[model samples]
Every structure is written in structure tokens, then in C-alpha cells.
Target: MDDSTLVASSKSGIEDRLSITAEFYTLNNVHANSAKYVLLFSSDPSSVIFFGLSPPPLINNNTLTLTSLALTTSFRFLGVWFSLSASSQFVLKQARSMVKDMAALLTLKKLLAQHVAYLYNAVLLSRLEFRLQTSLFFDSIVQSIIFPMFSIIKRKAGLASTTPLALLYLKIPFSIQHAFCRFLLGKKFLLILIFGNLPIMLFLIFKNLWVLRVVLLPST
Candidate 1:
């Protein structure tokens, strides 16, 4: 078959699979409400390609179409922001706003060091660390914004701006926190592979061997 025909057939197959899944859920009485929100996101870095086309409409077994699907530049899923270009800029922006608001409150209240730490853990830190596993692109930009806010709070609380003091009060730096989260996720994946079926176990072993070979052997 021609490329265009193959593409069309693949699209049809995907739509059919979605329809069958929706029907299964409907039979199970899932999402009995008529209102449904669907979003289409393209991972393409180019804006032109990302926004060029709309996703296919999803229809239920009763022929009810989900018309609520809209083209959005970004959307929140499971507390993590996902953008069309796969950039973490939106997440960083949101984190900045949240930290600023919390900082303003801390300054206005003239909160004690202990109180400020509690507030930071409850509000600002929670937001910063929320779904950290999903937003690994939060790099130096996020650290620059967050660490300064910590300094401001520390100064207000009459604490030194030293790294040790910051670490003592904040428990761990954001970079370290990110690394810990990644390590935990890696461990979880390893455990899954260890207990997984034969095919998955084989794939994991092969993947690790390939990675080790790539790291140990120089490219010729």
C-alpha cells in the first residue's frame, strides 16, 4: 500500500481501538455523565507542526460525540503541566507565581523562623515538589528563582544565607530532591522488571547491557 493509505489505515485502527475502549467503559458505567474533556497534544518542538492539526473526535457507543475537546497550549494532568512543545516553562512560571505569593505572605506576616518553615513546607515546598518526577526539566532556572525566595525568607527570619543553613532549614536542595525522585523511580522500574514477565525481563536486561556497552566502549 501507498504511504498515504497506510497512514489512513493506521489512523482508522487507532480510532477503532479508542471506540472499543470507550464502549467497554460505558458498559462498566464509567463516566455516566455526558460531559467529557479531551485534549490533543503534539510533542513536536515546532509550533507550526504542533498547532497545525486537531485531533480526531472521540465518539461513544451511543453515537454521542465529545465536542468539548479543545486545542490548548498546555494542560494540567495529575498535577503536572504538559505543554504542546514539551517544555517545562509553564510549570516553572506557575512555581514562580506560587513562591512569590507565599513569600509576600511570609514577609507581611513577619513570621518566625519556625512558623515560616512550616508554611514553606505546607504551601511553597509542596507546590515546588508536587509531581517532581514528571517535571525533570525544572533546572537551574527553577533553582535560581526558588533559592532566592528561600534566602529572602531566611533573612526575614534572622537566619544566615549560608548553604548549610539553607540545607538545614529546607531539609534538602531542590536539585538533590530531583535526583532522589529520579533514583526512586529508577528503583521502582527495576523492581517491576525483576518481577515482570519473561519478555519484559529480557527486554530490561538487554536494554541495560546495551547502555553499559555504550558507556564502556569508545565510539570508533
Candidate 2:
């Protein structure tokens, strides 16, 4: 079955809720029998879910419980990393490594300036597009990753590091990095969600934001 996450407000009823959920999904022929779940506490560790075995029906849970569930400080949900520690260095390090690896291909001698630019813009840079939508990238983080891609483009185009950055986008074949891709994409998504008028978005918008018509303006 596809991945799913269950959220509980407090320690109370966590066991019963999990058992009820597991049994319900298991009876429905979903892969809910595996007692595999990680706890990430945002505030007090004791304030969240209960620390105990799932149930006998969940086979894998028997060995997992010792009056407590496994607690982790960080875990990746889908492609984005979520952390209770509030440090993004791990995320940034991985992103930088990925960019560096992809940019290394730019050093190939066979690729023309346009070809280099095309590969960088189309393939390598597009990798970040999906991730940008999920996380808030600060300006420093943006620059840290963006500069490497630009540097590779500069090297491939026989330009020095000190060369005018504007020239790369204007004169050179390389396109400027869409550092605002995340914000632009988010705007587009919100526009669609707002104006598309799907039932769910409509319900949420009207329910929570009916009094706040200012959001209907250009770009709230």
C-alpha cells in the first residue's frame, strides 16, 4: 500500500486509536499490519503519542515495544526532510552534494556552450524545482546552491569566476537561475487552489477565510 501518516494530538487514546486504525485498514486489505512508525516530538517528548506496543495483530510491533516507541529527531516524509531539532544543515549538505554531483557533468569537453546550458537548465536544475515547492529556502541557502550551478556554467562557457553574473543570462547561452521558482510555483498553485474552485479548496477557503476577502486580491 502507499505510505500514510497518522497524527495524534496527545498521549491519551493513542493506543486505542492506532489499534482501531490498524484493524480498520487491515480488514480493508491495506498493509496496515506492519508495526512500523516513528515518533517525532515537537515539544515535550511525553506530550505526544503513547510509548507502548501497537498490538498482537501487528506482528512487527511485538519486538519494538519496551514501554516506549522508537523516537527519532528527524525523518523524511516524501522527498522533504522534517526535523524536530530545527537544524537544516543536514538538508543543505545533501542538496549541495546533489548539485555538485550533477554540475560535475558540465566539465565534459564534448558539450557545446548551448548544450551545456540546456543540460544544466533542463535536467540538473529541474531536479530542484520539485523540492523547492516543499521547503522554504532562505536567501543564503539559495545562493549557496545556486552559485555552484552558475560557476559550472561559467567554467563551461570559458568565463572567469569574476565575470559579470548578468552576462551569463543575457549574453551567454545559459539561463539565469530561477531562484524564485519556489515562490512562483507556490503562487501558481495557490491561484489554482483559489480560483479553480474545487470543492475541498472552496470549503476550506469559505469556511476559514470568508471574512478575509482581501486574499482575493492580486497576490495575497
Candidate 3:
């Protein structure tokens, strides 16, 4: 619980609970003076309303205190940016421009086709795959991201902009990439690990059974 999030319907509720938690931690010889929180009220702008004055400074038993949470329209957590406005055209616009630039520079060296293909996958596709798995993305966004990889292919092959999509990739020396399938397979591997571990499987069975019992219990 060193790094955690606190969510509440009002500013006072979060501050009150956090103070209590801080007290308990002080008794256990663990003190937290550094914590950051974002206040999100709505995905729609009109619904976002200020509830009260700024939260009081959070101080631990050591008398160390953190500054008040500042107003923010977006926040980055674990390398992903979430916008309060519910719109971000993905951060990889620059990643695409970067790959395109790298390809352009690599062309000057006249690298062999196989070498270019290797770099494209090892460097470019690998990053795209990592970003793909970070969160669930809309289909339209995925399609836009997918569309550029082929343009890179055509630029390298000296093909026309109107070159068929299949031919652009399938006919290339690298063969059509299965990155999306690979992303799906990565998720499937986690399921395999969860099922294979005996302790985890048993814990999951008991947890699920308890939940079902609670859910199916008659109302008072």
C-alpha cells in the first residue's frame, strides 16, 4: 500500500479516509509523505464541477507534507495518458514519424532488403506491439495505426501510393506481419499461466465460489 489510489465522491471524503490510513501506517513504522492524485469528475466537460476549496495539505506523522493536488485535464499513469475529455489521437503520431524518418535515413546507406526487414520488425514493429498491449483501443484507431506501416513499406520499395495493401506487405520479403495476432497470443499466454499454476487456480476457484454465493444469496 506504499503507492495507492484513493477515490471518493467528494474532496472531504478522500482527505478524511487518507488521514485515517496515514495514521494506521504511522503505527506500523511505514510513513508516506509522497502521494499524487488526480480529480476526475466527468468525461464530458459540462459535467465537471468544482465541489469546494482545495484539499488541505497532506502531512504524515513525520510532519512532512505534500502540496495540494493541482487542476489537470489529463494524467499519465504507467506510461499511458488518459484525457478527461475522452480524446487523444494516440501518442504514437511521433512514433510513426520517427519510424518514417529512420527509414528515410536508412535508405541512404543502401542496406540490403533483408537487413531493412529485420530492423523494421526488431525496432519499429516491436514498439507498436508494446503500445498495442498497453490498453484496449478502438478499432478505428487501430486501423489508422495499421495504415501507416504499409506506407513505410511502399516508400522503401519505390511503389506507388495506390499500391494494393496486401501486395505492399504480403509480397514484401518480411511477409505479412502477425503483430495483432501476436498481441492476442500474449494475452492468451497469461491465461495459460493462471490455469497452470495450482495455487493460483485453487485461489481463483475459492474466490469465484465465494462471489457466487454472495451474489446468489436472498435479499433481506
The residue-by-residue lDDT of candidate 3 on 1-220, one tens digit each, is 3354555545455545556555655466554434333334332232323323233343333222333322234445445554433444444454456556776667566655556666766776677666544344554555456565555556667779897766735645656555555556656654565568765765554331100000111223
Clashes of each: 0, 0, 0
TM-score top scorer: 2
User: What lDDT would each prediction earn against the true structure?
Assistant: 0.45, 0.54, 0.49
Better of 2 and 3 by lDDT: 2
- Clash count in backbone of candidate 2: 0
RMSD to truth, every model: 14.6, 11.3, 12.8
Q: Of models 1 and 2, which has the larger TM-score?
A: 2
**Candidate 1 C-alpha lDDT tens digits along 44-137:** 2222211111233443343333322123455554445655444666676776787777677667675566666566556565566663434554
Show model 1 residue runs off by greater than 4 Å: 1-38, 41-72, 137-139, 159-220
Q: What is the TM-score of each predicted model, taking all chains together?
A: 0.46, 0.59, 0.45
Q: C-alpha displacement of 102 in model 3, angstroms?
A: 4.6
lDDT of 2 by residue, 109-141 (tens): 576667766776677666766555445567666
Q: Give the per-residue Cα lDDT of candidate 3 at 38.
A: 39
| Stronger candidate by lDDT (1 vs 3) | 3
Lowest summed lDDT over 10 consecutive residues: which window, candidate 3? 208-217
TM-score of model 1 relative to the true fold? 0.46
Model 1, residue 214: what's the lDDT? 6
